[model samples]
Target chain A: MNLMLPDSGLLFWMTIIFAVVFFILAKFGFPVITGMVEKRTKRIDDAIGAAREAETRLRSLAQDQERIIAEAQAEHGRILKEAAEEREKMIVAAQEQARAEAGKILEEAREKIQEEKEAALRDIRREVAVLSVAIAEKVVRKELSTAEGQKEMVDRIFDELS
Target chain B: MRKMLVIFIALLTFMAHPVFASGSSEGEVDVAEMIFGHIGDSYGWHITEWNGHHVTIPLPCIVHSSTGWHVFMSSKIEHGHEYEGLFLAEDGRYADKIVEIGPDGSQVRPFDISITKNVASLMFGSALLLIIVLSCARWYRKHDALEKAPGGFAGLMEMMIMMVHDDLIKDSVGPDHRKYAPYLLTAFFFIFLNNLLGIVPFFPGGANLTGNIAVTMVLALFTFFAVNLFANKHYWKEIFWPDGPIFLKCPIPILQVIEILGMFTKPFSLMVRLFANIMAGHAMILGLVSVIFVAARIGPVIGGSMTLITMVFGVFMDCLELLVAFIQAYVFTMLSAVFIGLSRQGGHEEATHDN
Candidate 1:
């Protein structure tokens, strides 16, 4: 029970020892420990921040890639459609030009056939007239001994000329 | 668990051997004296009894008086026999203290600064604290890097220090925790180490430094000063002129008086709480061990059975004491943080209101 009482000697020593420990720990001990802990915490925070930034950047890059791909696909489709339309227009125009050239050649052939027919008719008419004159000369020579037939033939030719 | 078991077996062997060795020559055991002697501070370090011979390490007795400083080995006094005019007081109010024999045959109390058992233990604990903390601090300085993890003793200590900073100081002291963390960390580790060391019951462990009132008083005093000295004007105003009804202040100033008394009681409670808890723990364990000897007064068989049962219970109590040691240290530091935080609250409120 008497041990419960405080002793001056022990108290003095306790105070001295405790004060010395407090000063030493406060100055040399805690700062290093707490500083290190805080530094570790800050490092972790910075790492996390960097990771988050990288994640966002990756997301944006993916989005940009998707956009670019979509635009290229759309441009490819438009170019293909335009080429198909132009090819159809050129095919139609070539068909129309070939038909017009064939019609012009057929018209020129018809004019040449008409001119040759007219010439053939004129030649046939001339031959027929010569044959008729030769027959008439033979009939006159046999009939009246030539004087009366020659006078008739001369009269007919003069009438035709008038 | 295996270590605990070993300690238990060794302790049983030591206790059982002493009884049989002494045998028929044994005298009656003074249970009170035995228990108190185990728990109380002494001038020498008592190890254990062997072959009927008691082993103890005598410490130095240093005293100061009007005459001069008297220094000598405590063995010179021979456990109450006087030597060179100095003696241990055996009776009256100053019992167990070293007193000087005056020329007139009167007992004169000198200013004793002896390195008693408790003081030596305190010094031992201090040395350990210095060695561990300083070495860890040095190691941290050498391998200082923000991203690196701590290992071994430095890692263990860093975890504890971080706990004190984040949980105790930051939770209680708020933004100003940085200013108070160093002191709080020192107090927490110091008390914690001493508490753990006190439970050892052997060379480096038996000294009950934290159980001593003087030591607890000094610890509480540090908290008291830190709280009061750093308090702002608003804190003083709130204490002296609190917001309340006018009638309460006019007649007897009842509220003010209570507030004033509260300031002293807070630290006083801190002192008593730590001292009583530690001392009670040591006493309880000693009392339980003493029970076996008391039972031996009956018969051999019953005494033997009682010894086994008590020994088992003693082991359980020791484990509990280990837990209590940590609890007491934590409670002391947490309370200190709370008191300091409370003192700083007024200033924070005033600052916010002004803004």
Candidate 2:
């Protein structure tokens, strides 16, 4: 058989069947599968990008929390220091004022005690003057009756007063 | 068990074929004619013959003679019989073809377009490819390709599809490959499927469709058009006035002549390569099997050695033919891709400058 020369009939049918196959496949088969694969890749990429953004936000939030707590702790320490300093200053001022008040009261009490002692000395001196005058009257009457006895009494009283 | 049994019977037929062919007519076996007859296209699908009873599925025969049109089943002209003066020409220019007696008593061929064994197998192969590819495509439509991976036969088809579409065709066709993917995928699977089917020795197979020169010619023609039609200006320029030394272009245009010849020869080789490889494979297996009958003609001692030839060497050749089947299909598609890719290449000067 002459195998090299292509027959007209087989060649005709081959062309028709191959063309039909190509048309159907190009229209419905290939594009759908390839397109779906592309879409799936894109979705996966988008999902991964969103996950990365969320992780970054979470990490930043943790850092912010740490910074805020540090700041609050620093503020708390400063306030406590300030309050301690204030309390120390108040205590020192109160001690100084109490010492001054105690000194002032002591000075007033000393002054009052000097004035009461002076008044008490003046009343004792007056009572003593009155008692001496009554004794002198009685002695003068008795001495006139007896001149020698009165003279001796007056000498003894003058010696006692001296 | 049944399939093995069929094969054993077929082996018996192969042994009996020469005896039957010689005994009936010429008193000697023509081994070349016998091998060619098995591989060649026929109007009837010969299943088998047992006890002189020929069981065959007859196909329709259509022909247009110089006289008029005639259409009939091949069974109408069985066993050297004539239906409307048309019969299987036994010995003439168009031997084994549907022929009518010319006025000069010579055999004459008409314009024929019948459903031969090869054509029917072609239909079967193409239809099978359609079912497989379209079914996988439907599966892709039903489920998300990314979310749910294809399973079973669809999965197998996808793996093969990606290899052809992405790996082979894409790499070969360069960028703008998507435009060319459909033809390449179909051609690859078409050749592959037919090659596998051609190796089967039973019904629905055994029709060497790809081995037919006419069939491969049609396939090569498709690639031939795809390459030339879509090619850019630079591609044509390379073919007509190729980039070479001035001497090669001038002084009888040696390079230009070579380039032009290369274009046609590229596709021509594609057609011949597939046809010759498959045709040779079938012929080799037939030759190996026929050795047993040749030995049976001799005495028992050498007959045993000849049986050893068909047994050990024949099986080896069959296995090799199976490997050759896949390789030839792969080589055909790969070469087609390369040729088409070469035709679509841009200017090398521009390419070098960009780099």
List CA RMSD, all candidates: 3.9, 5.4
Candidate 2 regions off by >4 Å?
A41-162, B1-30, B103-105, B299-309, B347-355
Docking class of 1: medium
> Each model's C-alpha lDDT?
0.82, 0.81
Docking class for model 2 is medium
lDDT of 2 at B237: 90
Model 2 chain B weakest 10-residue run by lDDT: B18-27
TM-score of 1: 0.87
Question: After aligning candidate 2 to the native by TM-score, how far in Å is the CA of B165 from where it should be?
Answer: 1.4
- Kindly list the per-residue Cα lDDT of model 1 for residues B125-196, writing each as its tens digit: 989998998888888788855758789878888888888888888898767888888888888888989988
Interface RMSD of each: 1.2, 1.5
Score residue A21 of candidate 1 by CA lDDT: 90
Q: Where in model 1 is the C-alpha error above 4 Å?
A: A101-149, A158-162, B2-26, B80-83, B352-355
